[model samples]
Target: MRRSRLTLTLALGLLVVLAGCLGPLQTTPSATDRSTDGTTLSTTGTGSVDAEADLAVVSVAVVATAQSADDARGQVASDVERMRTALREANIPDDAVTTSSFAVYPEYDYSDGERTERGYRAVHSFRIETDPARAGEVVDVAVGNGASEVQGVSFTLSDETRAELRAQAIERAVTAARADADAMAGAAGLSITSIETMSTSGGFAPVERFDVAESAAGGDARTTFEPGPVSVSVTVQVTYRAA
Candidate 1:
């Protein structure tokens, strides 16, 4: 009986030792160990492409003031109609011209620390989209036809052009990211086995504005404008695994 009990205790101790040896090992995180198993190199790459602007937007407003709001609004409406007619005659499509804003506000005059109602001012603003080459002509026509305020002119890429540029930018960004990863991996004496994760982001082109007077001077000579190139950029972040 004593020999059998000793044998059973020895067997149980051997089993416990084997279980401890076969268990999973735990390790703390380190610089190269971001994952549970820990082996990745992450980098961000950026690229940009320049494209010529194919379209332009011209903003104009017709402002009028009178003793009564009704009178001011009526005058502004008439002026806006005239401006629209001029734009149409200048070969601008009717659909391209749309009302942006219209408002009537009271003008205040403070002479002796007292607010007095001077008159009602009405403003009607319109945005016109056209080809870059015809931008100056459009502005000239609108201003000649009683457009009291010339907000500004801006240049931008058309929808189709923008989409094309965005695709190109993304492709370039990916290429750049891969090049960066290759360099990093080479330095570390490791080869990139696979891509663990990747993300992409797009950038918007800046709007180029033309310097024109607020109230365009009435003249026969058309205002010259320049539509500079528009640029689109993209960035990509890639996490690569090395073994």
Candidate 2:
């Protein structure tokens, strides 16, 4: 009698397991598989190129701090206006000056803990684009007008130049990938069978920095400036498949 009861329980467990497995099997396919055009794509190819940038995008931010948050903010605002005036005086186009940040925060004495607040800090950041020849002058003009705090400075290529460099980089990367594929085919004593697939890659954009910017300010000394030619570069990656 016990053996029969045990067999009956085992059969019940098996039925439960089968029911769980088969329940979801009856569901309809998801709606995503049906395309409006009733077509599917299965193959893809990608290529890469490398080129040097012809233009430089430089980012400069000016920051200010004071015992009073309001005073600090007011000072930064005034300085920003003066900075614009100075840039205009230096013949920088108004369109080239863009404000990236305007922030006011309480200066905190973290040593006392997050609960205690100290003075205030005000910051205004600007993005300026000028001829590579005039970048140095723009930095000087900005600092002379009241830029006391420097948060970060970086450089990039302008859109037009970047496109140009990208084209070259792509071509080079494709050539390289092809060379690799060909080497594989030759070692096997087979002509390229077919390009199974291809893909592209991109990496870090670099900024060429001239260190002379440090001389932009001193208590009694005027900042003299000079800008050098800017070089921009782009790298492309490509993967190719063989016959």
Highest TM-score model number? 1
**Residue 40 displacement in candidate 2 (angstroms):** 22
The global C-alpha lDDT for each of the candidates, from Candidate 1 onward, is 0.87, 0.62
Candidate 2 clashes: the total is 11
In the order shown, the candidates' Cα RMSDs to the true structure are 6.4, 14.1
> Could you tell me the TM-score of candidate 2?
0.63
lDDT of 1 by residue, 149-192 (tens): 88988888888888899899989998999999989989988888
What is candidate 1's TM-score against the reference? 0.80
lDDT of 1: 0.87
lDDT (tens digit, per residue) of candidate 2 on 1-243:
999999999999999999998785565667896643321112222344334334444466667778898898888888888888988888888998888877899976766355667688888887777666565566677787776644434445667766666677667656655676666666765555445445555643545656543343555444233323333333334333443
